[model samples]
Target: MDHIFRASRQWERIQNRYITEDAAVDLTNLKSDPRNFKLSLWDPTTNGVRYLKTLAYHLGMELSPAELARIRRTPNREIGDPTTVRCGGETLCMDYLQATYEVGFIEREIDLSGARILEIGAGYGRTCHMIMSNHDISGYCIVDLKNTLRLSKAYLRQVLDEPRFKLIDFIEVDSLQDDSLRSERFDLCINIHSMTEMSPETVRAYLDLINETCSAFYVKNPVGKYIDKSLDGYLQGQEAVEMALENGPLRQLLDIHDSQAVQAAVPAFIEGYRPGDAWDCVGDSRALPWSYLWQALYKNPRKPSDG
Candidate 1:
């Protein structure tokens, strides 16, 4: 797999930086522990079904029978359960359901038939596989730490065909500033659950890159959790949005609170049917200020002269 999914040395530096200094637990260790890793655990059937239903309600789009069938067929790449959710005799993996929800949401907003997409923190390529398999994207780039991308590349290769796989390009974090990246432009940039974990400076850097490279962007992260003191201070969700509005070359189009999903998830979380640390309602802004999905759609700002 290493032979098939190669990484540049720059990826090594980024991986090291995250492991040694980042506030979150070492991703390498997290990747190894399937039981505790949030990505590894599968949501309950009830919660899973509710998530899909809620997303559909918000987007005003329903999943086709064929689309649901495809999701049921996609096996779980992570360790927990090959069949994460069993609904009406159909089995679906956690990643499959999540990817379906995310892709379905995006499809409602934009036609990704041949869009160029840049995804920061493509965990094991769950969403990547779903999007590539279902959509006719022209190009898809995954930018993340070396080890993380390695997992994604290997997992994706198992499910994606050669032609679809060929569309993928892996970019190391250290090379984010390269002329190649700066010159390139994308239809959309996506970051989910990653920016909230990063320092504000790191988040700002990525925002800068997204502004320079993409016409639109989507981010879904927690509202408030002061993970890094030096960079973000006490800011989280809305604060982050304010900062982006002030500095980034983009404006908000939508911001939806994720309370629906969070509310649906709380029951399973309380039952210990869900995985990872229990969803703590205390000390986390995501819960206190009404847990939000925050589907912020932003487009590049027009030049002052054009306006």
Candidate 2:
């Protein structure tokens, strides 16, 4: 999968550093605080710590002090310039809180225990860290850019054992005919925030891979292709009215004339269960706070298609 973001100078700089990186690379902001270049993951600067409390309330997640302490542990502390606030006598980053919500959301439907898992485009493996720290999965595989994999591998190794997880670079997954991963199987595959940054062809390629090897899939991304200032060109973007986002930059970008904006998904992203589609929708897509992103769960229990 040729990620569209890989073409950016930001990626190239990070990629070079990964090869010549030293001890300071451990605190590289490429994963956590890339100035204004988020790549796909949100850090404390873009996603402030303020909204996490409200997100918890909306998720209706109840946590005892002990659980909160466990859940809010900041794994990215040594990775970037993490912005932390003292909450409930614990230092927590907003990204960790969001990762916690993501884990909670997934565990609500499926049992992750001993479930072989794959997370494509995992940022710095924050969500992966959250899951592995809390649940004992059979094995976890992360497929991402070499630059990202390097950083995530470093960060994850700090907390995770080498044998428990595997990191595969995107270069290893070439074309639909590639059978390099044919021997592997997973109970679940997940992509968060980054799929929308990929081209339609790349996105479709991942779906094909998921359809082949995984029993279930989860994703949190925007539904439509809207203009974004950062990337200049458009990728799969979020819709305003669809996610019920308030009047803001996203609503402006959709060029809406009414109280709501309606736009169809370009290139036909498989976001939910529709008749004739392979996936069975687990539930309705839930909107993320203050953004056009929505989360959905889908399952395909049939044999991998041979076509």
Candidate 3:
């Protein structure tokens, strides 16, 4: 949280200096700031964190307790601040975006009261923030790597008034390791678009973990095949018509199970359309990245094994 809070501050400064500044002010003035120099030039919306955190990460510097405390006490002035989010250029109310994304994808409104749920890859505790702000799920744990856990804990403290809803639990063993998350289980386990950034091998392990951990789980962004190394900057570009088609690793796995969509995008899977069919799933109608909200559920009836 402290990291995110600090990152948020740095991000706002970036917006103020670069995005909002006029041409008269020398951009060199902006260059002098150590924080700005640290960020690798990726836009704020894409990376989430600002240059400070990246600098600390690269330099292997840890914030002292006093500095951490100061960051923790940093006013939550940006809590309700309006900013344009990455998705659809929507002017999202921070307080409501979390709740709305869940509601939109969950296919139902949430009532977490007395419900125990676990969210994998819970970045910045947005899901926890949304759930807590809206409903009363018993309590959810923000389980991630140690660094993310620490960062998210500080974020919750800064922005959230009652940060009781999220428990900061760091997974010691690798999240992809089978034995790591096997013993723990919950009512609902979720992996939103978060898994998109994971390595291909880890993605399989993540899916396996979710399948084993909870009776019912939600997996959005199930199409992982088109993520090509060459498409790094061009995946969403208009040159796909001329570029040689490549399948991402996830598609191979899904294809074996006959779940892979012949088309690059996933609406084909939902609409039961195949490649080269009379209708195309790739052209003008395609929604890159956010087109289909794949909500797969695992439902296994309880066996008669005596309780």
Candidate 4:
């Protein structure tokens, strides 16, 4: 499986900088320093219980008893001075919670049972694991940087069994150009918190691919100013989505604000900090600020150009 993975030039640069040959997939390594992904709160003392509770309340829902039990069983890491549960082993984390919320939102809006799904930028397969565990999907495709996909595949393989896991097809981001995959259609395509990190060309390329390969698509990204030094200079989430709507063969269906739990769980100073004009307090790192979570759905797919 490792031999099959290949990295694009864009991702190769990122891999050289952050990922190592002996990199182990674990909560500490993932949260501490990573090329493609970053964790907001890494303090050991920061407990996500209140944040999750508030998030569920604000979103007009609650975690079921089963979900709570599962969260408890997942592995956790204690980071700060007085260590607390910040990340769950395989089943619990901010990413896992957000994925669950997104799945619930989508479930209420559409019927995905037996639907063929394509997910771009599947981080560590948190969403993939959750979706497969909860839904009856016909097929699932994961598209991402080879390095990232390697970690995701390893992580998911540990959580999902042989039969259920076999439904997933791991495709490298660069492999999207293959005509066979490009021509294959999916019922839905999803991109979460990754587009903002992509260059304009890359974003447009993905939009074109999604339009060609999917009947509908969902995006969960920030709506305000964001900067990723590795890719585009400045990413205005709203502007990007609008560009896709205007240029691509898709129409906007639904748009909603991101969960407040993201802001609530972080320090108060970070909550008010704006990007460029402000500082990132959590990691004390220089990065873009996320003003709002923009979850949107677009429909009306089109065929790819023969040229």
Which residue segments of model 4 deviate by more than 4 Å? 1-92, 178-180, 226-291, 301-307
lDDT tens per residue, model 3, 1-307: 3544344776777666655555335466554343354454454435554543454343223333432332333334256343423322222333333334343344242234555577767666666655554445555655576687776677777666664534435453244454776787666666655555555455556556655565445544445344333324565674662232232224432331233353444543333212112221211222222333354433323311110
Model 2, TM vs. native: 0.62
TM-score of each: 0.55, 0.62, 0.49, 0.53
Clashing pairs in 3: 1-151, 1-154, 1-155, 112-136, 112-137, 113-136, 225-248
Better of 1 and 2 by TM-score: 2
In candidate 4, which residue pairs clash? 44-80, 75-89
lDDT of 2 by residue, 1-307 (tens): 8746435686667655542355334555545455323345555444544555555443334554544754745343435666555555555566776676677678767788777788888888788888877777777777877788788877777756555455332332332256746667878888887765665556666777788787788787655445443432223445532343432112224422222342333113344212126777664444444245566777774843111
Q: What is the lDDT of residue 239 in candidate 2?
A: 59
- In angstroms, how far off is 178's CA in candidate 2? 1.6
- Superposing all C-alpha atoms, what RMSD in Å does each candidate have to the true structure? 19.0, 16.9, 16.1, 19.0
True-vs-predicted CA distance for residue 137, candidate 1, Å? 1.1
Show pairs that collide, candidate 2.
none
Which residue segments of model 2 deviate by more than 4 Å? 1-79, 161-177, 228-276, 303-307
Higher-lDDT candidate of 2 and 3: 2
How many residue pairs collide in each prediction?
Answer: 3, 0, 7, 2
Q: Which number leads on TM-score? A: 2
Residue lDDT tens for model 1, 32-85: 443232344443322555664444343223446755755654544444334344
Cα error of candidate 1 at position 235, Å: 24
Best by lDDT: 2
Report the lDDT of model 2 for residue 194.
77
What lDDT would each prediction earn against the true structure?
0.58, 0.59, 0.45, 0.57
